[model samples]
Target: MTKLLLGRYLPGDSWVHRLDPRTKLMASFYYIGIIFLANNWQSYLLMFVATMVMVALSKIKLGFFLRGVRPMIWLILFTVALQIFFTKGGTVYWSWGWLAITQYGLTNGAFIFMRFVLIIFVSTLLTLTTQPLSLADAVESLLKPLRRIGVPVTELALVLQIALRFVPTLMDQTTKIMNAQRARGVDFGSGNLFQQMKAVVPLLIPLFVDSFGIAEDLATAMDARGYQGGDGRTKFRILQYHQPDIVAGLAMVLLTVGLVFLRA
Candidate 1:
């Protein structure tokens, strides 16, 4: 959990690091949506290459991006396995009662796995390269038009940034809780599945208490600082587009066209 980097930012001066938050944020979402357009190996390969290129541009180690996927590995495999076993089409490689492995099932399973990895990699790239606060600004800017309909865009953005920022904090807190419990003779790793879950109960209670206390303290600090809601508030930093953002936008456009062309 501590090694997970999904919501954590790493400061760098790479090309990807310098992209406008709006570009990165929108591109991440846009890439995810276009992933569904991939139906065959050609399209998947193209998307995979594009994703890897973006990762390479970020100049972060591939291992860090991989760590982001590690925590979700089980879930990904379970889902891919379900798709393989339950989905039926093409040639039947094996069959037993209601379960069957077919050619189409294998293909679809591979596609699903690729989809999951690609999405996670892209998302991890966004969070790693862009600060949470910058993401909040991008989200607020993009959703500003919704303010006309009385939507609370500023508050929503604040919530998003806070959630992102707290992920690392909560992870660190979990690590501390585990360590403290371990010192008192709680074994987290040496047990069966049910036993491990039962052991986690001791960890969660205190963690929740601490989390609530932290939240309360934060709220008090905000109150003490006379922090009002985001209406008529000014930003300390303004987001601006640059050549890199334009390049990124164009890259996304080209990737979209390629995927459309390559989709089976």
Candidate 2:
């Protein structure tokens, strides 16, 4: 759980870290969309290279991004395996009762694997580089135009920010609770499926209790500090696009255009 890096922010002054949060947020979305445009190995290779270059610019070690992928490794492998075994087309290379590995299956499985890694890597980069507050600001800014339609964008953004902030805290709390339960002879790891679930009840009860207590304390603190919703609130720091943001946008455009021409 501690290895979960999706919602946690790592402070840095690297090029990727210095961009406006809004830019990073939009770029991540753009990359995800363009990634699907890649159909051939050449297109995927180009995307892979572009993604790695972004990682390099972030200046965070590749290992941290990889660690983010580790938690999803099972999921990635399962999806890839499904594609490899279930997808039918092209030359059949091997066969078992109802499953067969074919050229198309192998190709599709590789593509799926690359897609999973690239998406996860880009998303992890966004969260690792952008502060929760900045992300909320970006969200709120992007959604601001919807306010005329009566959408509560401010409240929604605040909720998102709080959720992101709480993920790490909750993970740590869960870890501590697990250790305490272990000390009390509650074996979380040893058991059949049903038995494991039964063992988890004790762990969950305390976690829920603690979570509520934490929420109550936060509410009290917010009330004491007079955080009466986002009405009339002004940001201490404003988001502004710079030269790097423009360059980054241009690079994305080029990548998108390249994928269109290169994809089969």
Candidate 3:
């Protein structure tokens, strides 16, 4: 019943929260690139240290960050197992019939697991501090040049905005539906894998029905307001990149360079 995918946004007055969404988005991309470019334990350790500093600066609780990672533990474990059993280089640590564990595999698995965890943690932190509307605005502004290529940047932004906005709402609805089913003697966790999946059928039906209903209502509301797409739409609040954003951008660039140099 716990919706782990719906990570909670913790409001804070930290430097990260003050950053322009566009800057944060670009930084996130650079950070992920650095994470993947890291090839050894030393570079990975440095990246981890840098990420921890960013986390501390964000002022969001460490507990929240760990909680956001809980859902991914199984996936991390699975990757670890796959790498440990399949990677054939280095000294063999264990051998049992067809299954083998090699030192190289273990190291590779651990690195990959940590890499995925850091990527998720850092990206989720960005989302935690950013408002969905602000993200939409930032994305729209960033993609404005695509308009020259006949791409509908405004429509793309609207879709991203709606998707972000609906995430929390959908999570809430799922919780409500699960609780209602629980009250009606439906047990989601008390059955075989197949049976448990079957239990979700009832939940899925209502979820879809309500999703369509909400979409219809939203369309009606927009239509009532004479809403038109991408046609001279004016914003009351314009996004501005300030000095702090510039500093953050520079820091991200430096971080990227440091990470690459450390790897080399």
Candidate 4:
């Protein structure tokens, strides 16, 4: 099973990894917007190609993106199946009683699945390239404008940083708990769906308790360090955009335009 990856940064010297964190963050948001605009297979295909280019630039294998998707594969498959079953339009390819699969449904399901894949790949690329600390800095910088409106940007960034930092830890905790349960003859993967869900309650209870315990420990550690708000705090590494960052921004702009044009 693929565990969740929150801020799993893979260090590299490639151009994608070298861009300023803010650039990557903004580009990610823009990419998400463009993805929602895609209404055709051609647009989604182009977007997937764009994502692959980023993967190549970041010096990561395509399998890296696919690996994290194992856990979600069931969800994706279910979603696509639901879309195929529910959507009613166009020619009916297969009919059984009141349940009919139409050409439109197949098209919609395929497009939605592609959209999901592209978004997942792009977001994973962003986190894989940018470190958690850098992401915090970028989020703080981006949210600075909201500070004047009484937004607690620093606190929000801190929450985000902590959440990202603990994703792997929580995943590890879940794995250990599951393993222990399985050893004791807990059938998490067998039986009917309801029975499987009942088995998960035991897992969730302990996981939540441990999560809270970890959160309390984190708070205590931060308090022990005399941590305060980011009023006058300075970063050890400063972010500065380079030529490659600008080029990447321009490329994103072009990609967005192309997706818009390609939308059916």
Candidate 5:
């Protein structure tokens, strides 16, 4: 759980880190489109290559990104297992009454897993490169046009900001609670499934209590700092698009085109 890196930011001087948050945000959507557009092995390979290029541009270690993927490993496997056993049709490989495996099942299962992996990889890159505050601002800027229709973007942005901000805090608290429980001889990973769940219950209570306390503190601090919502707000560090952002944006476009061609 501690290896989970959603909404966490790491500071770096890489061009990916320095690009306009809006451009990065836009590119992320296109990248996600590529993930869905991947219909064959060739398309998947192309997407993988493009992602590696982006990772190189970010200047973050491949291992660092892989480490953050640890938490989702079980989920990916479970999903694959589901598809492999339940999906019907195509050549049957094995069978046991209601339980069966087929070539179709295996192929679809692998595709789903690869799709999830690609999504996670790109998302990890986004959070690792973009700071939380910058992400919030980028979101606000992107949704600014929606204000013409009265979307209440400020409240939405605040919610997103708080959600992103608490991910690391919750992760830290989870680690601490686990450590404290371990010290008390609570065997979290021992015994049956129910027993493991029982051990986790003790950890959750304290974590929730601490989380609420921290949220209260944050609200109080914001109130003390005169946070009167996002109306008429001014930015200290304004966002600006540069040549690198344009070049990166163009690269994303070309990558998307290549992925589409590969899929076709």
Candidate 6:
């Protein structure tokens, strides 16, 4: 269960792992921008090549990336079907009673599907290399300026960190509950849409109850520690922007500019 939502965090001393979390976060944004900027096959090919290069640098196994993508298979298929059957403009490929499959639809569907896949894979690469703690720290640091506006940066960071940490735990709990239901002669897979929805109720109830219980326990623990929300907290390790981070950021800027120019 922990294995389900936590994704594959492959431990390696690769260049991606050594990159600053801020750099990776910004790069992810730039990468997504480029993905959306893509118009034709040429831009898509360039984006794919760039994504592949990032994956290669991450040094995570291809299996890990595929595993991350498995959950989105249904979504990709749904988008493809939606685009192919609904989009209109180009030559008609086929037509049914009230549905039309046009050449434009096919092209649009393929492009959207590939775009989604590339976005998912590239984002997964960022998470695979960057530690959760590091991500939280980077986010907190990035949002520090918001403190001037009376925003609680530390509390926000803490919430994000706890959410990330518990994601795997909650997934494990859900899997356990699902298996327990299955063992009790409950067929979750083999059912109509309504039946499947009904079957999930039992699973969801237990999951929600357990989640509340865990939240309560966490609150109590925090209370026992005299925890105050971001009053005057001091970090054990402060984040420093290194030269590599600056270089990476500049590269991302260039990538964004290049992609924008290509689109133009």
lDDT of 1 by residue, 96-205 (tens): 99999999999999999999999999999999998878888998999999999999998898778777778879988999899999999999977689999999999999
Q: Residues 52-162, candidate 2, lDDT per residue (tens digit)? A: 999999999988899889989999999999999999999999999999999999999999999999999999999999987888889899889999899999889888878
Which segments of candidate 5 are over 4 A away from where they belong? Answer: 1-7, 155-229
User: lDDT ranking from best to worst?
Assistant: 2, 1, 5, 4, 3, 6
Judge candidate 5 at residue 205 and give its lDDT. Answer: 94
**Candidate 5 all-Cα RMSD:** 5.2
- What TM-score does each of the candidates earn? 0.76, 0.78, 0.77, 0.73, 0.71, 0.75
Global lDDT for candidate 6?
A: 0.84
Task: List per-candidate RMSD values in Å.
Answer: 4.2, 3.8, 4.0, 5.3, 5.2, 4.5
TM-score of 2: 0.78
| lDDT for 260 (candidate 6) | 68
Scanning candidate 2 in windows of ten residues, the lowest lDDT window is: 1-10
Q: Sort by TM-score, best first.
A: 2, 3, 1, 6, 4, 5
lDDT of each residue in 61-172, candidate 6, tens digit only: 8787787789899999998999999998889979997689999899889899889889889889988998778888888988899999999998989899899988878887
Compared with the true structure, all predictions reach lDDT values of 0.91, 0.92, 0.85, 0.86, 0.86, 0.84
Over 163-186, each residue of candidate 5 has an lDDT whose tens digit, in order, gives 877887888889899999899988
Please state the error at residue 99 of candidate 4 in Å: 1.2
- Top TM-score model: 2
Off by over 4 Å in 6: 162-228
Which one wins on lDDT?
2
- Candidate 2: where are CA atoms >4 Å away? 1-7, 160-228
